[model samples]
Target: MTFLGVFAWSPVSSATVTTTLGVDPGAWNVWRNRRLTPAPLSRTWFRRASGSPLVYQVSDVLVWLATKRGEHIDPLTTWRLSLARDFGTETSDPVEIRRLAVLYARAVGPVIGGVRFTTAGFQAYLASLLSSS
Candidate 1:
């Protein structure tokens, strides 16, 4: 259930996934949520403002930039850097390749859903992090 740079995780302490979006839309109270759209999964909103979870069906989509190491990933980066291209082309070593694959998944989730990196958002996000470093 992973996307370009996001993990398809269920609510682990109210972790959520969202779609059918527009504006803030008041936390899953929109028609799409009410109807329970099948095409996209819904979950409670991770209230960034309050730093809490709110019950609702929403497209509260999250983009994880991953916090893995030079050769390690915890939970987010594996999804963020997911996909073959997200995987570095260093060596065909199974271990190295697998590590890259995991990193790919961590770095990028279903932000694009099998779609290649065709948006400026991902690149921009990476640039922001690098600049901060």
Candidate 2:
């Protein structure tokens, strides 16, 4: 998903971001500042962690895939599914669990955007991946 950078910004630590998205916060900082291209979509307040240590909200990491991107869903459904697997959330049988994961990921995978992203998806995705592979 693509954000126009108009959403509310929160004060989150890099540890929170890494714990959720499994990516180093430094990469996001570099990419958001335009130093890198086609990196995960994240919106940050500052470019570098010069003065104070950087902080990141879980939403910052999810905005890349959950927000709108051009026309398509940016990372594609397959990518989302793969991400779910990698994160340990399988999209297999058992309609109830799969449905829950889908709903969770669609809502923003283990984080909150406008108070929507939550840990439900995080656990679901992680669980799914573990069972699948």
Mind giving the per-residue lDDT tens digits that candidate 2 earns over 1-133? Answer: 2222211122244444554556676776776588442332233323333354444333333444444343333222433444354456555444544344355544553443322222453454345433321
Error of 1 at 118 (Å): 34
Q: Choose the strongest candidate by lDDT.
A: 2
Q: Which consecutive 10 residues in model 1 have the weakest lDDT in total? A: 56-65
- All models: lDDT? 0.32, 0.40
Off by over 4 Å in 2: 1-10, 35-51, 68-133
TM-score of 1: 0.22
Worst 10 residues of 2 by lDDT: 1-10
TM-score, candidate 2, is: 0.27
RMSD of each: 13.2, 12.3
Q: State the lDDT of candidate 1 residue by residue for 1-133, as single tens digits.
A: 2432332221222223333223244554463467532223222112232444333211123322121113433323332333233334435344443444444433554243322222453443333233221
lDDT for model 1: 0.32
Q: After aligning candidate 1 to the native by TM-score, how far in Å is the CA of 105 from where it should be?
A: 7.7
* Candidate 1 stretches greater than 4 Å from native: 1-22, 36-82, 88-133
